[model samples]
Target chain A: MKKLINAVEDVVVDSLRGVAAAHPDSLKVDLDHRIVLRASGPVDGKVGLVSGGGSGHEPLHSGYVGRGMLDAACCGEVFTSPVPDQITEATKAVDGGAGVLHIVKNYTGDVMNFDMAAEMASMEAGTRVESVVIADDVAVQDSLYTAGRRGVGLTVLAEKILGAAAEEKRDLDALLALAQRINEGGRSFGVALTSCTVPAAGKPTFDLSDNEMELGVGIHGEPGRETTTLGTAADVASQIVEPILADRDFTASPVIAMLNGMGGTPLIEQYLVWGEIAKILAGKGVTVARTLVGNHITSLEMAGCSLTLLSADDDLLTLWDAPVETPGLRWGC
Target chain B: MKKLINAVEDVVVDSLRGVAAAHPDSLKVDLDHRIVLRASGPVDGKVGLVSGGGSGHEPLHSGYVGRGMLDAACCGEVFTSPVPDQITEATKAVDGGAGVLHIVKNYTGDVMNFDMAAEMASMEAGTRVESVVIADDVAVQDSLYTAGRRGVGLTVLAEKILGAAAEEKRDLDALLALAQRINEGGRSFGVALTSCTVPAAGKPTFDLSDNEMELGVGIHGEPGRETTTLGTAADVASQIVEPILADRDFTASPVIAMLNGMGGTPLIEQYLVWGEIAKILAGKGVTVARTLVGNHITSLEMAGCSLTLLSADDDLLTLWDAPVETPGLRWGC
Candidate 1:
C-alpha cells in the first residue's frame, strides 16, 4: 500500500497528533484518551454533542468538532470502534451543566461501546448522556462491519443540523428527538470505483476490474450488495438515487442533499455526479433546499461517492444554515 | 485508468455543467464560452479578478468564482490550458470598467493564452487588463509543463488575498502590485505518491513503485527534481520545507502556510503531514501566522501533498482574513 504513514500501528495516533497541531485554536486533542475535544469545552448550560466511529471516515466525527458541532469526538483506530474507556472519557469531558449526547453510528461495535460509555457516564459521573444510533446507509441490511444499516453520509448532515440546535441550548430530550428525526428523514447510498487499503492490511480491501464498480459499498471497504460494470455519471447517479427514493418518500419536504466523495474521487467527477443527481431529483418532483458536494465523509483513499437526502422542514434547514466552525465543515463563522 | 466520466472528450463541459448547476445562486456559467462567472458579475467600478488554468486543479479557478474571491474563471479541458478565445471572453465579461486582472499560472500555454487574451481585450473592448503570472513552485528550475517554475499552491493564496484587496476597491495597479508582491514572496513544493490519469489519456500520467515517491512533482504530473523511497510524514515534511527556506529568507516576517493535499490523500493524512510541517517550521523559528490545510489546489486524484508559504504583511494578512464566499473557499460570508 502506498500510504503516507510512519507505521501501521502508529497511523491513528500519528494522525491525531497532526490534527492537534493543525487546529490549535479550535480543538484540543486529549492525547492519552484519544478524544478530540472543543478547545474550550464543557460550555456551561449548553448540551454537548459527542460522536465518533472508525477513524478512516475522516472529517466525519473529528472534523465536526467545534462551535455549532460536537463538543468532543472519540477517535478510534481505522475502521475500528473506540474502546469504551475512550468513549466514557469523552462523555465526561464534554459534559456541561447540560447533559451530553452520544451520536453513534449503527455499527455493532460502535453501538455496543457507545452504549456502555453512556451507561458508565450516567452511573459514575452522574452525567445524563443520551445515545442516538444513526443508520442511514441504504446499502446492505447487514454488512461486514455493521449489524444493520451502516451510518454513512447522514452523520455529516446530522452533526451540522444538530450541532446548531445544541448551540442554541436545546435540551437533551429535544436534541435526541432532532437526532431521531434526522436519522429517520435521511437515507444514503454509495458506490465504489476502487477498494481502499487499511494501513495494517497493506493491500486493497478488495479488487475489481477497471470496468467494474461496487454499488452500495460501505465506508470501510465492506463488500457492497451488488457489483456491476461502471457506467456514466448520469447512469450511475440514477442507480444510487433510485434506491434512496424507493426506500422513502422525500417529496413531502424539500430535502437537504449531499453528494459526498469517497476519498479518492476528484471534485470534477463529484460535481458531475451532483449535476445528474439534481436533474434526477428535479424530475421526481423533489426540490433540494441545501446542497453540500465534496469529500466531507470519506473512506481513506477509497474512490467512490455517496448520496444522502434528508427531508427537511424549516427548522432543520435553519439549523443547517447556522454558523459552524470546524476543520472539515466550516462556514458563516 | 479508472474514472467516472462519460465520453473522455465530454469531461470539461460536463463537469462545468455540474459546476454551473451546483452553484447557480453564486455563479453563472457562460456555457458557450466555458467561463464560470459570478452570478452578479462585473460590478461597475470594481476591479475584476479573472483566473483559470487546466480543469483538473479544481477549486483553484472555478470553485473560487464567487463573492470576494474571483469575478470569473475560464474553464479548460482536463490538463489543458484554456484557449485564448475563452480567456478573452472572460476578460471582456468581467471588465467592470475599473479594469481586469488576469491571474495566470506559469505554465507555458496558460501564459501564452492569457497574454494573447490581454492584448485582444485591450484592442476589442478597450479594457485595461494586467496579467500577473504565478510561478511559486520551487521544485524545478524548469518543468515539462512550464518553462520556469510551475505555479502550484500559491495561486490559491494570491487569488484569496488579492481578491479581498480588489473587493475593497483596490484599483488595478494596486491589485497588480499586491499580486506581484505575493508571487515574489510565496513558494511551493509538491510530492506525488501516485500519478493521476487524465480521462482522455486513459492512463496514469507517470508511474511510481509501491515504495517510491516523486519529490517536488508539478501539479500536472510533471516529473519532480528527484524520485526517492517513501518516508515518514515528518521526513517528507522536512524534505519539502528545507529547499523552500533555502530559496528565500522568510524569517523577517510571519508566514502564511498551507499544507495542500493532491486530490486523493485523505484529510487525516493531510493533517498529519501538516503536523510535521508545522513542527519543522517552529524549529526553524518561522512563525506561521495563518495556516490552511486541505486539498484546495488538487492534481486530479494524485495521492500526495504540497507546501506553500508566503511572507505576509499586516495588509496582506488583513486581506487574507477578509470574508470570502466561494464554493471552494468560503469564510465570513
Candidate 2:
C-alpha cells in the first residue's frame, strides 16, 4: 500500500481533525468521545435524532445531522458498528428536553449495540430514547437464515424524512411512526460489480467472475442472496425491480424511485438503469412521481448498484416537502 | 470482478430507486433531471443553495440538502462531474425568489461545468448565481500541477457551514464571503493505504505496493504528491499534519481538527491515529477546541486517511453553531 501518511494508526485522528477544520461552522468534534455534533443544541420541543454505524459510510450519520435530520452521529471503525459506549455518549450528547430518537440500521451488531444503548439511556437518566431499526432492503427473499433485510440505502431516506418531522415539532411517537412508515414503504436490492476490500479485513469482501454478479448483497460486503449470470441493463432491472415490486405491492401505487450506485458504478450507468426501471414501472402501471439516480449509499469501492422504491402517500409527500439541513439528503421548504 | 448486480449497466439507476423508495418524505427524485430535491417548492426569500460533484463522494452534495444546507443537489457519474445541463436545471428548480450559490469543489471538470451552468442559468433567467470553489487540501503544496490542491474532504464541512448560512437568509454575496472564509481557514492532507477501483474504469485508480501508500490523493483517486512506505499512526499524522500546519500559520491558535477516513481504513486504527495527532497538536501549542473522526468525505474503498485543520474565530464558530436541516449535516437551532 503506497500511502501518503506518516503512519496508519494516526489516520482516523488526522481525518477527524480535517473534518473539524473544514466545517468549523456546523460541527464540533468531541475528541474525547470521537463524536460529531452541531455546534449548538438541537431544536426545542422536537425529538433529537442521533444515528451512527461504521465509519466507511460517510456523509451518513454525521452528514445527516443538522436542523431536520440527526443531531449527532457516532462513527466506529470502517465497516464496524460503533461501540455501545460511543452510542451511549452520543445519545446523551444529542438529547435535549424533547428526547432522542436513534435511527439504527438493521445490521446484527448495529441492532444489538443500539438496542442496548437505548435501554441504557432510558435507565441512566430517565432520558427518553426511542429507536427505529430500518430493514428496507428487499433482496433477501428468505429472511429465515439471515439476520433480516440489511438496512442499506433506505436509512438515508428514513433519517431525512423523520428529521423533517422532528423539525416540524412532531412528537417522539409521531416521528417514530413516520420513520417506521417510510421504512416499511421502502425496499432495496443491491448488486455488486466488483469486490471491495475492508482494510482491517484486508481482503476482498467476496469474489465474482467478470461475467457473473451476486445479487442482494449486504452493505458490509456480505454475500448476496444468490448469484446470476451477466445480463443487459434492462434484464438486471427486471430482476431487481420484480422482487421489490412484488414484495411491496408497488405496482398499484405511486412510488419514489431510486437507482443507487454501490460506490464504484458511474452515473451514466445509473441513468441507463433508471430508464429500464421506468419502463418496467410504466408497464406495470406503477406511477413514479419522483426518482433519484446516483450513489446515495455505498459499500466502499464495490462496483454495483441497488434499487429502492418507496410507496408514497399524500402525508409522506408533505413531509418530504418539508425543509431540512444536513449533508446527505435535503429538499423542499 | 465479483459484483452484486446481474449487469454493470444497471448500477446507478438501481441504487437511485433504492434511495427514493427509502425516503419518500424528504427527497423526490427528479427522474428527468436525475436530480434529488426536497419534494416541494423553494423557501421564499431564502438564497437557493445548490452543489454537486462526482458521485463517489457520498453524503456530499445530495446528503447536504435540507434546511441549513443546500436547497438542491445534482449528482454526476461516479468520480465524474455532473454535466452543465444538470446543474442548470437544479439551479432553476431550487431558485426561490432569491439568488443561487453553487458550492463547487475545485476540480477541473467540476469547476468548468458548474461555471458553465451558472453562465447558462444567467442567460435563461435573472437567477443570480455565485460560485465558491473549495480548495482546502494542502498536500499538493503547489497549484502549478494537477488542478491545484484537489478539493478532498473540506467540501463536506464547507457545504454544511455554508448551507447553514444560506438558511440564515444571508444574501448570495454574504454566503459567498462566508464560504470563502471557511475555505481559506481550512486545510487538509490525505494518504491512501490502498487503491480503489472506479467501476467504469474497472481497475484500481492507482497501483500501490504492499508496503507503500500514495500521499495527497484526491477524492477521485488522482495520483498524490508522493508515495511513501507505510508507517504507524503517529508517523502518518506527522506527515499529514506537518504539511497542513506548515501550509497555514495556525501557530498556537485554537483549531478545529478532523481525521477523515478514505473509506477502507478501520476506525480502530483511526482512533489510534487520533491519539497521536492529539499529542502532536498539544506539543505544538495548538488549541484543539473540536475534532471529528471517521470518514466524512471518502474516495471509494481506498484505504487511507486525511487530516484537516481550521483556525477558528467567533464568527466562524457562530456560523458552525447555526441550525441546519439537511440529510447529511445537522446542528444548532
Candidate 3:
C-alpha cells in the first residue's frame, strides 16, 4: 500500500510516537501498552472518561485525550479493536476516587472488549466502571465488523459531551444516563466516493467504479448499503439527510450538525457538501445551532462525507461549548 | 473527475457559501466580493491582518480569520490568485482606525494582484496598506507558479504570528518588520505522492507511476526538483530536512515546526511521517519546541506532506501560545 508508514505491523505505534512527540507537554504515551494518557493525572473526585477503538479513525480517541475530554485512549492496530488487557489497563490508570466511564462504539469486537475490560477492572481493581455504547450510524442493521447499527460519527460527540459532564464531577450513573440520552438523540450516515486500503490488506477493502459511490459506508471501509452512480453535492446531501430526518424527529430543538469527511476529501468539497446540507436543513425547518465541517472522525483515506445531527437543549449545548483542549477538537480553553 | 461538486465553475463560491453556513456566528461572508470577514467587524484600532491566495489550500486564509488572527480573507478561485478589486474591498472593509497588513504568498499573480490592490487602496480609500510577501519554500529556486520560490506552508505561520502581533496593536511598520523577520526565519519543503485534480481541469494535475513520487513538489502540483522512487517515511524525511538545514542554520533556537498534510493524506500517515522528521531534527541538534500536525494548508486531494520550521523567540512563542478562536486553528481561548 502507498502509505507513509514504516512497516505494516508498526503503523499504530509509530503514529503514537509522533502524537507523543507533537504534544509532549500535554500528552504521555505508554509505548509498550499502546495507551495515550493525559500528561497530568486524573483528578481525585472527577469521573474518568476513556474511549478508543481502531487506530485509523484519528483524532478520535487519541486526539481527544486532554482536558474537557477523555483521560486515556487505548489504541489498537489499524481497524482492529483494542484487546481486553489494554482497555483494562487504561480503565485502572484513569480511575480516581470517582468511577470510570467506558465510551464504546457499537462494533461487536469493541463492545465485547470494553465489556471484558469493565468486568476485569471491577474484579481486580475494585473500581466501579460503567460502559456506554454509541450506535448512531443509520447505515445498516449489521455490517462486517459490527452488530446493530454501527457507531460512526456520534462517538466523537459522545466523548466531548460526556467528557464535559465527567469534568463537572458527575457520578458514573449520571454520566451513563447522559450517554444513553445522547445515544438516543444523535444519528449518523456516511457515503464513500472511493474505498481505502488497510495496511495489512494492501488493497482497497471494497471496489467502486469511477462513477459509482458507496452509500452508508462503515468507518473501516466495509461494504456500505449500496453502490450507485455518484451525484452532485446537493443530491448527495439529500440522500444523506433524508434518511437521517426520516429516522428521527429533530424538531424538538435546534441541532448540532457535523459534516465529517471520510479521509480523502478536501475541506473545499466538505464545505460544498455542508452548504447544500445546510440549505436542505433550513428547508426542512431544522435550525442548525452549531455546525462543524471537516475530517474530525475519518476512515483511512476514503473519499466521502458523513452527517451527524445531535438534538440538543441548553445543557447539552453548554457542555459542548465548554473548554476542550484536545488535539483534534479544541476551543474555549 | 469523481468529485462532489455541482459544476466545476461553481466550486469556489459554493464552498464559500458552505464556509458561511458552517461558521455564521464567527464569520461573515461577502458573496459578491468573495471575502470572508470576521462577524464582529474590525477592532477599533488594531492593525487588520488579511492574507489569502488560491482556494484549494483551505484553512489557510479563510480558517485563520478570527480574533488574535486575521480580520479578513480574500479567497481566489481554485489555484488562481484573487483579483485586485477583491483585495481592495477586503483592505477597506477590515481597516479600523489603524492601518492594514497584507500577507501575500510569493506567487507572481498573488504579488502583482495584492500590490495593485494596495496601490488602489492608497489612492482611493486613503488607507495605509503595507504588504509582506512570504517566499519560504526551500524546494526550488523557482517554480512553475512563482518567480523566486513558491510560498507554501510558511504562509500559515506568517498569518498566525503576524496576526498575533496585530492583536497587540502594533503599527503598520512594526507589523511589517515582524512579518519580514518571520518570513526570514521560516522555510518550507514539500513532497507529493500523487497529483491532485483541479475540479475544472477534470484530471490529475500531473502524472506519477505507482513507484514514483514528486520530491520538492509545489503546493499546486507544480513540478518539483525530481520524480524519484518512493522511499520509507524516514528516508523521505531526510530528503526534505537535509536541504533545509544546508540552506539555513536552525540550531540557534528552538523552532516551531509544522508537519502539514496535503488534503488526501490521513492524519495517521502525517504523524508517521512527522515521527521520522522529529528523529532527523533531533539528530541534527535542531530542537523542536512546538509542533503542529494536520491539514492546515492543503491542496485539494493531493497525497503528500510539507514541513515548516520557524525560528522563534519568547515573544513569538508567547504570541503563538495566545488565544486564537478561528475555525482552523483554535486554542488557548
Candidate 4:
C-alpha cells in the first residue's frame, strides 16, 4: 500500500496530532485518550454532543467536533471501535451541567462500547448520558459488523441536526426524541466501485473487478445486497435512489438529500450522479428542500457514492440551516 | 475507466448539470456556454471576478463561483482550456459597471484563450477586462501544459483572496495588483502515487509501480522532477517542504497553508501526512496563521496530495478570513 503514512500503529494518533495542529482555534485534542474536543466547550447548562466510531471515515466524528456540531469525538483505530475507556473519557470531558448525548452508529462493537461508557460515566461521575444509535443504511438488515442495519451516511446528518438542537440547549430527553425521529426519517444506500485498504492491512479490503461494483456495500467493505456489473451514472443513480425511496416515502415532507462520495470518487462524478438522482426525485414528486454534495462519510479510498434522504420538516430544515462550525460540515457560521 | 459518467464527450456538460441542480440557490449555469455564474451577480458597481481553466481540476474554478468568490467560471472539457467564446461569454455575463477581472492559470492554452477573451469582451461588448496569470508551482521551470510553471494549488488561494478583495469593491487595477502579489507570495508542489484516467482517454494518464511515486508531479500528470521510491509520511513531508522553503522564506510573515488532496487520497492519510508537515514547519519556525486541510483543487482521482503555502500579511490574512460560500469551500456564511 502506497499510503502517506508512517508506521501503521501510529496512524490514528498522528492524524489526531494533525487535527490538533490544524484547528487550534476550534478544536482541542487529547492524544492520550484519542478524543477530539471543542476548543470552547462544556458551556454551562448546555447539552454536550459526542459521537465517534472507526477512523477511516473521516470528517465524520472527529472532523465534526466544533462549536455547532460535536462537543467531543472519541476516535478509534481504523475500522475498529473505540474502547469503552476512550468513550467514557470523551463523555466526561464534554458533559456540562445539563447532560451528554452520545451519537453512535449502529455497529455492534460501537453500540456495546458506547453503552458501557454511558453506564460508566453516569455511575462514576454522576453525569447523565443518553445514546442514539443511527441505523439509516437501508442496504442490508445485517452486516459483518452490525446486527439490524448499518449506520452509514445518515450519521453525518444526525450529528448536524442534533448538534444544532444541542446548541439550542435542549434537554437530554428532547435531544433523545429528536435523534430517534431523525433516525426514523433518514435512509441511505451505497455502492462501491473499489475497496479501501486499511493501513494495518496494507492491502485492499476486498477485490472488485473493473467492470463490477458492490451495489450496497457498507462503509467498512461489508458485503452488500449484491455485486453487479458497472453501469452508467444514470443507472447507478437510479439503483442508489430507488432503494432509498422505496425504504421510506419522502413525498410527504420536504427532503434533505445528500449525495456523498465514498472517499475515492471525485466531486465531478458526485455532481453528475447527483444530477441524475435529482431528476429521478423530481420525477417521483419528492421535494428536496436542501442538498449536500461531497464526501462527508467515507470508507477510506473506496471509489463509490451513497445517497441519504431525510424526510424533513421546517424545524429540521431550520436546524440544518443554523450555523455550524465543524471541519467536516460548516455553514452560516 | 470505471468513472461515474454517462459518456466521454458529455462529462463536462453532465457534471455542470449536476452542479446547477445541486446549487440552484447560489449558482446559475449557462448550459450553452458551459459557464457557472453567481445567482446574485453583476452587483451594480462591484468589480466582477471571472476564472476558468480545464474541467478535471474540480472545485478549482467552477466550484468557487458563489458569494465572496468568483462571479463566473468557464468550464472547459477535461484537461482542455475553455475556448475564447466561453470565456468571453462568462466575462460579459459577470461584467459589472466597474469592470471585470479574469483570473487565469499559467497553462499555455488557458493563458492564450483568456487573453483572447479579455480582448473580445473589451472590443465587442465595450466591457473593461483585466487579467492576472498565476504560475505558482515551484515544481519545475516549465511543464507540458504550461510555459513557465504549472498553476497547481495556488489558484484556489488566489481566487479566494482576490474574490474577497473584489467583494470589498476593489477596482480592476487594485485586484490585478493584489492577484500578482498573491501569485508572487505563494508556492505549490504536488506528488502523485498513482495516475488518473480521463473519461475521454479511457485509461490511466501515467503509470507507476506499486512501490514508486512521482515527486513534484504536475496536476495533470505532467512529468515531475523524478520518480522516486515511496517513503514514510515523515520522509515525504520533508521531501515536499524542503523545496518549498528553499524557494521562499515563509518565516518572515504568517502563512496560510493548505494540505490539499489530489482527489483520491483519503482524509485519514492526508491528516497523517499533515501531522508530519506541521512538525517540520514548526521546527523551521514557520508560523501558520490559518490552515485548510482537505481536497480543494483536485486532479480527478489521482492518489496523492499537494501543499500550498501563501505568505500573508495583516491585510491578506484579514481578506482570507472573510466569509466565502461556495460548493467547494464555505465558511462564516
Tens digits of per-residue lDDT for model 4, B95-195:
78989999888999999999999999999999999888888888899788878988878899999999999889988889889998999999999899999
What is the Cα-based lDDT of residue B246 in candidate 4?
Answer: 95
**Residue A40 C-alpha lDDT in model 3:** 98
Q: What's the best-to-worst order under lDDT? A: 4, 3, 1, 2
Residue B302 in candidate 2, Cα distance off native in Å? 4.3
Q: Which regions in candidate 4 have their CA more than 4 angstroms from the true location?
A: none
Candidate 2 structure quality by residue, lDDT tens digits, A237-290: 888788787786886567777777776554445556666777788888889876
**Candidate 1 vs 3: which has more DockQ:** 3
What's the TM-score of chain A alone for every prediction? 0.99, 0.93, 0.99, 0.99
- By lDDT, the better pick of 2 and 3 is 3
Better of 1 and 3 by lDDT: 3
Better-scoring candidate (DockQ), 2 or 4: 4
Candidate 3 per-residue lDDT over residues B1-333, each given as its tens digit:
889899999999999999999999999999899999999998988998888889999988899999989999999999999999999999999989798999999999999999999999889989999999999998899778788988989899888888888888988899888888898899999999988999888999999998888999998999888999898888888888987898889999999999999998999999989999999999999999999999999999999899999999998898888888899999988
What is the TM-score of each predicted model, taking all chains together?
0.99, 0.64, 0.99, 0.99
lDDT of 1 by residue, B131-208 (tens): 899999998987787888899899999999989999999899999889989999999999999999999888899999
Per-residue lDDT over A1-333 for candidate 3, one digit per residue giving the tens place of the 0 to 100 score: 677878789999999989988999999999888999999988899999999999999888899999999999999998999999999999999998899999999999999999999999999999899989999988788888887899989999999999899999989999999999899999999999999989988988988999998998899987777898999999999999988999998887999989999999999999999999999999998989989899989998999999999999998999999999999999999
The alpha-carbon lDDT assigned to residue B172 of candidate 3 equals 88
Top candidate (lDDT): 4
